[model samples]
Target: MRNNWLIAACCIALPMATGAIAAYVTIQNVQFWYPVLRKPIFTPPNAVFAPVWTILYVLMGISLYLVLREPPSPKRRLALVLFGIQLFFNFWWSILFFRFHSIGIALLDIILLWLFIILMIRQFYRLSNKAANLQWPYLAWVSFASVLNFSIWYLN
Candidate 1:
């Protein structure tokens, strides 16, 4: 149905829109704020971040959409709330790392973010396996990002 398609589109748009807003915030500080940092040895090239985040954001949107398509229940509602909380952490990491230029705080924030992602994934699994599966890439990325954040904080 057209309505179903529209709902799906909107669900997908939510995370993508959040990512876009986060990216906008990050870019504002990256050039002047980021360049001076003492990056870790394994830090990926600057160009790698945008494409990787774009794909991850799309996947995140798809995962949320899958969860939203299911019938509403208390468990489902709780899962949605968890998803939103993790997203807040996700969005703020950029602000902590880039805008405020606080690497140590960013590292701590990202560890919390990684834990939230795991909780979100488990919650998603209870509602929809596909949704939970879709979040694995995000979990993996955030896990990696957590280590990177720690390394940056430690090295710098």
Candidate 2:
């Protein structure tokens, strides 16, 4: 039981830690550089992003924990690989958009991120429905974000 709890904690921490690192990169530009961009009118207030992402990361972590708890197999390995790839894209989006101020590149990164998310969801579903369901909100948010990213690129 303790081992399970420990594993769960580690699972939850992984994405949360990734978010923290991405947030560090984002903070570098969010105040000064980001304000100058011609964001889409539909863009949420800056205040909305933190909380939404926080929730999404937690959900992602829980989903990960669920998957990790499943028996080890080729499917499990593939799911883990998919999760890692999507996460890498997710982290880099912040760096591309905020740190480097490359909106066009970030848009491309986000489109890839969105696709990887769908693939991850499909793989997760094969293992656990609850795990896959948890990813829906993340996907939804990223979908909205993809449009927002494209709009920002187009406007600027």
Candidate 3:
């Protein structure tokens, strides 16, 4: 009983800390981010991004719980590590593109991040079908973001 709550507590912590780190990265570069050459039409409203990201973060937390619930194995451990790397790249891209305004490096970072995510999805799927299923939405979002990033890089 106690262990379940402990696991849940850890699950909650991961995304929250990631989000907090992402927020700090944003706060340090708001003005710069606002001026970036974002693509038209599909670009979401400022208000929309916050809510959407919030939902995704919650989903991420639950997905982590799913992965953690499974039996231990080297494969699961590797998947988790890959997931962490993708997340690190994910968190850093915002800072690079927005805070530093390095479009070229950001583009490269996003590409690598996308690859890592796809790999993570594959590994996660192996651990638990549901765990892999949960990452599909995240994969879709990143697919869209990659196009967006390419468009911005091209535009600039």
Candidate 4:
């Protein structure tokens, strides 16, 4: 029981900390650079992004925790690998879009991130249905973000 909670905390901490680091890299860009961009008509207010992303990252952490608790197996291993890859791209997107201001490359990165999220969801489902379900919001958010990314790229 103790180990379970500990593992869960660790899993959650990993993603949340990673997200904070990514946010740190983009903090100045979001405050200064992003405001000047040619955004789409449907763009949410600047205040909307932080809370939404925090929730999504928490969901991702829980999903990963569920998967990690599964017994060691090939399926579990693959799921973890896919999760790591998706997480990497998730982190990278912030740097690419916000910090570097590479909207075109960020669009491409988000598409890849979207696909990888789907793949990760599928793999997680094979092991834990709850784990896979947790990723739906993350997937949906990213899908919307993809369009926003493309629109930003097109406008800019």
Candidate whose lDDT is highest: 2
**Two-way lDDT contest, 1 vs 4, winner:** 4
lDDT string for model 2 (9-128, tens) is 899899999989999977969999999888878999999999999999999999999999999999999999999999999999999999999999999999999999999999999999
By lDDT rank, best first, the candidates go: 2, 4, 1, 3
Error of model 4, residue 138, in angstroms: 0.2
Task: State the C-alpha lDDT per candidate.
Answer: 0.86, 0.95, 0.78, 0.94
Model 1 over residues 1-156: C-alpha lDDT tens digits? 898788788877887888889878888688887777777888888898889888888888888888888899998998999999898999899989998888888888888889889999999999999999988888888888888888778778
How well is each residue in 1-156 modelled by candidate 3, as lDDT tens digits? 899888877886787688678778777566556555666567766676667667666666777778888889898898889878988887888788777888789889989988998998899888888878877877787788788778878877
Candidate 4 regions off by >4 Å? none
- lDDT of model 1, residue 66: 86
Order of the predicted models by TM-score, top scorer first: 2, 4, 1, 3
Error of 4 at 47 (Å): 1.2
Measured against the true structure, the TM-scores of the candidates, in listed sequence, are: 0.95, 0.98, 0.89, 0.98
Worst lDDT 10-window in candidate 4 = 9-18
- Displacement of the residue 43 alpha carbon in candidate 3, Å: 1.3
**Of 1 and 3, which scores higher on lDDT?**
1
Task: Tell me the RMSD of model 4 versus the true structure.
Answer: 0.7
